[model samples]
Each structure stands twice: as structure tokens, then as C-alpha cells.
Target: MTAKPPPDPAAPPRSPWPGSAATAPARPPEVTARRLVARSRIFRVEAMDLIFSNGAQRTFERILGGRDSVMVVPVLGAETLLLIREYAAGTDDYQLGFPKGIVDPGEDILTAAGRELREEVGYAARRLCDLQRVTLAPGYIQHGTRLVLAQDLYPSPAPGDEPEPLEVVPWPLTDLDGLLARPDFTEARSIAALFLARRYLQQAHQAPAADGKGRSAPGNASSPSPDETR
Candidate 1:
């Protein structure tokens, strides 16, 4: 039998997966010129002339917005999630998704999430966890939304600027598949938020409780588990 030779020390480490070698990112295209193409009450489009590193030129149009928004996944107890059904102007139909709103100027993300939760779902959360910041159609749109997970809720309804009252719906966390199958729950951002919140909750539940000695704490009959706080 032939013996295998030693590995090359000077060569780069091999990737565990075939054809999955990492490569350096390409240089971003430079903007040669930019001009406002259109403006509306809620949107502004800007046209840009770009020159790529390869000397290729292209004109791109992107939506410009300085403000970011927040979407809250309000966990109404251990298993329920508070969602909203509201008229989406873009679709001209009612869309089912988490409570969300634009973060007001000078307002923090968690605070905006809490406020939107109260306005849309008639509840305020004592605990808020930021899951992630996500963008929609980043190739054209410049808007971002911060996803938040809210818990320990209390009723605190507030008036909002909606054209009509939003219908609040409580969904079970375990029924995420059912929610995903609904046609009205097709918003990409909301779907991403749902998965992110689920992953976070699962990890939190699996984490061992620690004590002062950096050891797992003994389970107490009176103490609530992570599931109970969810």
C-alpha cells in the first residue's frame, strides 16, 4: 500500500467544503455623479452614475431615506406573539405582520419598538431584546429596520396615525409554520424577524443558569424557567 505524503506547510488551509474557498470582496463601484430623480411624500429616488474598478460605468437608481424603523415581536406571555393586521399602502391590502413603525428623530431603537408595540397592540413590554438590523432590497433601497423581541407585556394603548384601527392578533410561537403559510404574512422583514426571534428564544432556553461560582445553578421549585419568561 502507498503511504500519503505530508501536507504542504506553505499552502493555505483547505476548506472543509468543496468549492467553498473564501475570496476577498471586490472593490465597491465609485459614484461619479448623483441627482434626485423623483420625490414624494414618503419616498425619494436618486440616480447615480457609477464607475466600477473594471472601468465599467452604469447608472443606478436607489431610494434614499435617512430614517430607520423598528419592528417589534411582542411575546404576550410564554407562547403567544402579538401581531398586527393593517392596510399596507404598497399592496393596497391588509398585511399581517409584527407591530412596526419608524423610529422618531432622537428616539432609540428599543424605545421606538416599545412605543410601536403599545400603539399597535395596546401593550408595553418590560423587556426588549434587539435581534438584528435588516434591510429590504439593499441593491435599490437604503432603508433599514431594527428587529426587536419584547416580553413581560402590560396593557398601555396609545393613539397612532393610522388611517383606521389596526387589528391585533395573538399567535402562538409554536404555530410559526401556520403563520408563514398565510398569504397576508408575506412581508420579508417580518418573516426574518420571526425566525431570528425563534432562534434567540431557543438559545436562551438552552443556556444553563449560572451562579457566582460560574457553575450551573440548582433548579428551584419557586423560580421561573426561561420558558416561563418567554
Candidate 2:
């Protein structure tokens, strides 16, 4: 008839600590502090390094330093994606990834994106989406890599004065699963870029019907919806 004392208040109000709410102890301070003792570069490869910071050693790869740059994912046709393989002397392995390079001191990321697209794939994009900005490696590197999604492309003249022997390869979309599953698809920046690009492309291709025939305004158009299928 007394409602069983309201079932002892249903587990009691949480005191944010393991003590009686009426006399609970104060909570500990949140973790919001860190110190950078020092940082030194022990080894420097092109755009990368083996760095030691605050007694912690890590690989610092500068996809883009304080400067601006771009990474272009070129989707050719509906079934193939264009990629580049450049012989990386440091690792002595062919690094296959979206075309990416430094921003040449004063250029913006978007401009550099277009330039890298042309240089690596001999193509230009009529429309490119800014997918996201991400750090190459936050624990060590002081730089970030910008991921861009490119489409509506056309062949441009070869970057007449090529600097490196870049092999432009057309990989079938169906093979993307295999490429990612391979043991060597392991570079941080490239991995991040490919995943972001793949996610964006998949969503774009499978996008639901729009209410109208005309394409949505540029900013209003979908910008790489997260991988719902996954």
C-alpha cells in the first residue's frame, strides 16, 4: 500500500562517484592537460621523418606542413578509378595512391588539388568536393592532409615537364575492395584519403532520388555522406 517505498528510488541518484549521494566525495579533474617536452627530427625522408618528441618516438610524415596542398581522388567513368604509382626511394617500394604533393609556398589547397590531379593523372576535374581535413598523424606529425573528391574529369595535356616517372593506373571499382585488403595499402595519408574518397563516391553513386530534376546548388549538394552501407 506504500508503493514499496518507490522501489528504493530505482538505484538512487548517481553521485558521479561510488559513494552515498548525501556524502559523496568530489570527482577527479578531467583529463585536459599535456606537455610537449621537446621534439627532434632524427631522420628526414621526403615529406616524412622519424621524430622524437617528449621522449616519444614516432614517424612524422608531412603531407602538408604549414603550407597548403591537396590530394585528388580521380574517379574515371563509373567503374574505374585513376591512381598513381610512384617509386618511393626511401622505402624502396612503389607507393600507389591518389596524387598528392606540397602546396608550393603560396598556393591554396584547392588550386594545388587541381594541379596534382593534372600532374598525376593527366586529367582535370570540372567539379571537386572538399571532403574533409585530417591530420596525417596527430601524435607525431605537425601537418595534416586534405582529402578532396574529384569528378566530371577530362584529359588534360601531360604535365609537359614531368619530374618523376609516374604510372597512371586505372583500377576497377570492383578491385577497390581487393586493393584495400592487400597487405601494402598502409600509408596513413593514402589510406585516409582512399577511404574518404571511396565512401564519398559510393554514397554519391547510390544517392537517393532528389525531389527535383535540376542538381542542387553547389553547397547544397551532398558532400560525401558517411558510409551507411557499412
Candidate 3:
């Protein structure tokens, strides 16, 4: 008898790639039942009873997610990157990062990206390109983040729920080393989006087909909108 091989990480996924395939393990554990263990204003903890294919059983805890979120990488100019300095309760300090917000119900990811750009960065993008979707702390968090590249921006502002106004910081993409050296630019999601966006822009710039039409880059395709499930 021959044993079946595990799924190949190098192989393309059946659906769009959401996270790093390198992190995926073969034969995912099936969740038998989920029971609410605790609830707070912002978080709901669920106790998950899971059974692996090999007959192993374990209990895991995860936070119940409400809605998807979008992180906007707005291009201020040929070399400029717009970031925001906002207060992070988890860190108990301010962090510098991109314009990001939750995707409200009934709105698609692209629209939500544009909305967040206006609300957080005081600008609305004429062309919004999709970069990728990222999951932060996927082992416990049920939510995912959609990264977007915003270009051809025009001044537009909207009211936001932030207790204090966010300080918009414009950094040059060429100075990534300097930005990374800063103590405040430490958000994992933001860091990933920045690098991905930079790579996409570089590819798009190299591609003759891009032609500054605001389309997505060649290989970095956008995932399905928030209205669709993976």
C-alpha cells in the first residue's frame, strides 16, 4: 500500500491565496463544536472543540470577528507614501501606519478602501488597486485584512469615529529603511502591506502593460471582494 503525499505548498491554491501557504499544515483539524466562553464590548471568545484526522482532539479558543477590514496604501506622489499616527490601545501608545478601517456592512472592499482613505488620510483616490489579503495572528483571530493601493488621490475628508484626529505622516517609499527604523512603525499588517504595495508598484512600473492606467500589477492579483466568501 502506498501512502498519499501531503498537499504541496508550492502548488497554486484552488482559490486565491489569502495567507502564507508555508504556514498551512496538512489535514486541518475539524472544529466539532464552538461554544461562547466569554463576551466583551469588542471581543467574543469561543471555545472550539476540534478533532484532527489522526483522531487527536483538542480545545482551542478564538475571538469572534465582526467585519472585515481594509488597509489603504495611498500614494501621495511619485515617491510618497501616506501613513497615519494613531493611538493604539493594545500598545498603550501611538503607532505610525497606513490608513485603515473596518469594512462596513453592505460595502465592498474597494469602496471601503476609498472610504478609509478619505476618513483617515483626508484624501480620496481616483484609482484603487488591490494588493492582497492578510490575516494577522490567524491562529486565534477570525478576521482578515484587505490591502489596497490607492493612487491619483484628490483632497477629500470625512468624519471618523477616532477619539482624536489621526496625524497624517507622509513618507517616501525610497526611505523604507528609515521608516522601518522608527519605533512606531511596527504594525505587522501595515508592514506587510507596505512591502507588498512597494513590490506591486515596482512590478507595475516595469510592466509595459500598466501604462499608468491604475490597473493591478501583473502577478499580484486582487482577491474577491468582501461581498464574496472565499
RMSD of each: 9.4, 11.7, 7.3
Please give the CA lDDT of all the candidate structures: 0.83, 0.64, 0.83
Q: Which stretches of candidate 3 lie above 4 Å from their native place?
A: 1-26, 210-230
Query: Residue pairs in steric clash, candidate 3?
Result: none
23-53 per-residue lDDT for model 2 (tens digits): 4323322223333444456422222223222
Where is the poorest 10-residue window by lDDT in model 3? Answer: 221-230
Which parts of model 2 have CA positions greater than 4 angstroms off?
A: 1-64, 158-163, 210-230
Per-residue error for 60 in candidate 3, Å, reads 0.5
Off by over 4 Å in 1: 1-26, 212-230
- lDDT assessment of candidate 2: 0.64
> What's the ranking of the predictions by TM-score, best on top?
1, 3, 2
